[model samples]
Target: MELVDLTTTPAEALPLTAFKAHLRLGSGFADDSLQDDLLAGYLRATLAAIEARTGKVLFERVLQWRLSRWAEAGHQPLPVAPVTAITSVALRNAEGGVSEVAVALYGLERDTHRPRLFAKGATLPAITHDGEAVVSMTAGFGPSWDDIPADLQQAVLLLAAHYYEHRSETNGAVRAMPFGVVSLLESYRNIRVLGARS
Candidate 1:
């Protein structure tokens, strides 16, 4: 299974000013704008880390997912949560041909934790041979920083500040989430249920 982000949150939509305040950086400095870019980078990295840890997308963005086969005949659990819409579904047959599944045939089951794709009738189309199936959808709580839940927004801010302050001691390239971050994100994490898909 492969899932890729087709679109990402706009840089402008980030809470640059708020992050600056969190960092206690004064706006009077000539390089303040430049610092905004740096802060934005930290926020972006922190958001990515939080999302990776929690399996939740904090901001709304388009994502494309590819799977070899359906988890179930009628209902396919989406890899991500808070899916807003299913843009399209495509099937690649064994013969190396691709076709778009009719939108009316299936619909998105938008759940906060375990969103899924459910067939409208009988069952979803089956792959007869070696092939791939693709599902594209929009997922996330909201489109902007303000759209995110208050706790998550606070988490991002706290984590970004931590990253900004610890840049000298830690490797910025490594996405090592701190315990405080994990604690903040713990409540938002999705708990996978193990059982037969019935």
Candidate 2:
């Protein structure tokens, strides 16, 4: 299975100003924007790490997931969560032939954690011999930083600040996420039971 990000988060959608404020950096200075890029890098890394740990998308974007076979006959769980829509689905043969699946055949089951693509009928279309199925989707809380849940937004800031403070640390010891950040992300995580499909 392979998952790809089809669209990137726009710079304007990032909470740069808010992050700066959180850091309490001086304003109205000649070199005030000098650390902007560096700070942005930390923010991006923090967002990615939090999303990976929680299996959620912090910003709205398009994604494409490719798989060799369906997880189930009529329903296939999505790898990420808060999916807003299923853009398209297609099957590609080993010989490079592609066939588009009709949108009417399947629908998106919007779930906060384990979203799925479910067939309207008995089962989804089959993939040909040595072929793969590609599912395109849009997933995330929303496009703007303000669209994110308050707890999640606070978590991002906290983690990013941690990264910023440890930017120059040379210690070889590993570090774990702060307890506050972890607590904030706890509810967003997907807890799978034993023998569960997801």
Candidate 3:
């Protein structure tokens, strides 16, 4: 199985100003914007880490997931959430032939944690032998930073600030997420059942 991010979060969508405020960095200075780029990088890294730990997308973007076989015939659980829509599904043969699946054949089951692509009938279209299925989807809370849940927004700022403070640390020790950030992200995490991601 492979998952690819099809779009990047726009710079304007990031909470740069808010993060600066959180860090209490000086303003109205000649070199005020000098650290902007570095700060942005930290924010992006923090968002990615939080999203990976929680199995959630912090910003709205398109994603493509490819799999050799369906987890289940009637419905296949998506790898990430909260999935807003399923854009398309296609099957690609080993010989490079592609066939688009009809939208009428399946529908998106929107859920905060475990969204699924469910067949409208008995099962989803079958892929040829030695083929793979590609599912394109849009996932995230929303496009703007304000659209994120308040707790998550706070978590991002807190984690980014931590990263900014420790930017020069070369200790090489593994750093765990702050307790507060972990608590904030707890509810958003996907619960695995019986050793399987739900």
* Number of backbone-clashing residue pairs for each candidate, in the order shown: 0, 0, 0
lDDT of 3 by residue, 12-119 (tens): 888988999999989999998898889889999999999999999989999999999988888999999999999999999999999999999999998888999999
* Candidate 2 lowest-lDDT run of ten: 167-176
The numbered model that scores best in lDDT is 2
* lDDT tens digits, residue span 41-116, model 2: 9889999999999999989999999999998889999999899999999999999999999999999998888999
User: How does model 1 score by TM-score?
Assistant: 0.91
Question: Can you write out model 1's per-residue Cα lDDT over 72-103, one digit (the tens) per residue?
Answer: 89999988788999999999988889999999
Q: Per lDDT, what order, best first?
A: 2, 3, 1
lDDT of 1 at 117: 96
lDDT, model 1: 0.85
Candidate 3's TM-score reads: 0.95
After best superposition, candidate 3 residue 53: deviation in angstroms? 0.1
Clashes of 2: 0
TM values, all candidates? 0.91, 0.96, 0.95
Q: Relative to the true structure, how large is the alpha-carbon lDDT of every model?
A: 0.85, 0.92, 0.92
Higher-scoring candidate on TM-score, 1 or 3: 3
Worst 10 residues of 3 by lDDT: 167-176
Model 2 misplacement above 4 A: 172-175, 195-197
Show pairs that collide, candidate 3.
Answer: none
